[model samples]
Target: MTKYRLFTPGPVEIPERVLAAMAKTDVHHRTKEFMQIFSSTAEKFRQLVDSEHSPLFLACTGTGALEAALINSAQEGELCLYVSAGKFGERWGKIARRAGIEGVPIEANWGDSPALSKVRETCAAHPEAKVFCIQHCETSTGVLHPIEEIIPMVREECPSALIIVDSISSITTSSLSQRKLGIDILICAAQKALQLPPGLTILGLSNRAAERIQEGSPHSLYFDLKHELKNQAEGSSSWTPAIAHILGLGEVCQMIEEEGLDHMIERHNRLSKLCRFGLTQLGCTPVAEEYPANSLTPATPPEGIDAEVLRKKLQNTFHVLIAGGQDHWSGKYFRVGHMGSFSEADMRMFLGVLYDALSEMEAKLPEKAEFETSLCSFV
Candidate 1:
């Protein structure tokens, strides 16, 4: 039997050690052992993101954490600026709207990073905007926004606005330091760059963000960060937690510490460079030019080549899974993820398979040359 490999952005392959850790017998959530695991994992999360203040953990998806940040930071009917460049970015707008907040979307074309100037102009126009929400890495288009540049502009222009970032894919893949970046709320999930399975979400809240929650908002229940913090202070979750996932997360944290956070990010950078180089040599153009995502790369399909068909062939024939584009780009582009539980060898194999699939579809590609170029680029 052949083993299947996952190359999608979320639900990336889990490390064997992490899987083994999850296989352990379930422990009582109230026990000291569980709390120890929780505390240790929280510390590692802070170290990984280089946050001075620790983040809170929730047994939820990345979207749940995002909602938590939105609900806690801003009040109903308040102006919220959403910098939307892709699907996930648009989701932020949708979430804000659902929460009864007035969401003003700053639109950017898909495959394009959000412009700092545009964000600044929006803030200046809507001085009443209480929360500025943006995705650090837009997974759909594989575009990395200029958060570092935009953050300062927001800080200078709208000092009262809290910066909420969805760093789900960029947490470990890119060089991100939440505190240093001046982000008030940073939301991430274990299923992305953390190399763990879904079921755990983390929110690194700045003191300013906590104070905003205390000031009051209509957002309540299930995702209230303030309530979660109170429960976490006593070493517990407000709701029943996923014990096995927490155990797996503990092991993942150990692996991350052992590898060193900076080194891990550097590794991801190297792998992303290789993937981009290989894709370019294959005559496939990347979606984003200015700031391509470090975790995943979305490649536009060659003329007359159906990306969805190619993606299906890659999975069915080669036992490799790749993600298809979402929303408007659906079937037009496909994504190759190089984050979490993936190594240089895995990337080489994936690229080779992609080359073979494209060649079979009559898309002339410089397979051997591109592979060599990718290797040289990585080195």
Candidate 2:
């Protein structure tokens, strides 16, 4: 297969070491050796979110983890509140509604952050809400919510509410501490900032969340948090595990630990800023005006250029695969992923190929397209 460097929001580039780990000899999930691997991987995974080490690992996408979090945290006829700022944020309400829970949407413009006053108002109105859902970084718009501020405010307003943070695309790309922020449930996956192929969903929980699951009905066997906690605490999954993904996750965690979490966050932030700078130099407009996510950046093509056309051109002409928009913004903007395995050198490569593609398109060029290409700060 031809190797096309991918810049999609999730499933970012995989490191060679992680790939090697996944390709190594497979182990039986029921064996003591596999249990040690599972238990060790779970510990490392929780540290990524700065949470206590006892997170649940499920062989599913971020959506499935979100579902598991919602169903297991809240019961039927319970009140659930969520922010509807982008594609993933909208999922919270949809999931709640599907679960027969009363879901309230705290609406916001797609690329804008949710208003703090509005969120506080929602908390006041729905004081009985079982769980309040919000995405740390909405991948579709690349908008990073002020969770550090929002979480504290929500905690103060709705003391009884269980706050659920979907950090799927934001974990390693951005900085967050689940315990410090008082988050009840934190969900992430192997694909995004973990630098691994999709399959594993890691959910970090607090003691309160575990108690809720113990007293409440999860409604499903596979996603039952109570059962998973009891079994996984003993180094076993309730069902079949994704052996390769677990192994890859262990390698990724080790890599991040060695690199230092603070340094990794700085690297992703540098790359994300550099990507936006390069895009702006090419006469493009970044989608997120405020609090943009470090994981990826969404931008509109230079004036008069179709986003889809540019995305395909980048893929076909340059062998660089970027992503187009979803839902109402489809064909309106394109996104570039710079999280996980992407490094300073990769960001430079992205700038070069993007410049080449735009030059071939003969798109109206910026009068003075000046952006930093210096790696001095990066090193």
Highest TM-score scorer: 2
* TM-score (C-alpha, index-matched) for candidate 1: 0.95
- Cα lDDT tens digits, model 1, 1-379, are 6677889998888888888998888588898888887777778777777665667888888888888888788888888888888888888888888988899998999988757778889888887789999999998888899888988988877888999999999987888888899988888888888888888988887878777876764557787766777777676888887778878877887887788888988989888888887787778888787898889999986677899999998888989989998877888899998898678888888878888898888997665775667556656
Q: Give the per-residue lDDT of model 2 (tens digit) for 149-242.
A: 8887778877888999999989988888999989999998888998888899888988888888788786687888787888999999889988
Provide the TM-score for each candidate, comma-separated.
Answer: 0.95, 0.96
User: What range of 10 consecutive residues in model 2 has the weakest lDDT sum?
Assistant: 368-377
Q: In model 2, how large is the Cα lDDT of residue 145?
A: 93
- In model 1, residue pairs whose N, Cα or C atoms come closer than 3 Å (at least 3 residues apart or on different chains), thus clashing, are none
Worst 10 residues of 1 by lDDT: 370-379
Judge candidate 2 at residue 47 and give its lDDT.
71
Q: How far is candidate 1 from the true structure (C-alpha RMSD, Å)?
A: 1.8
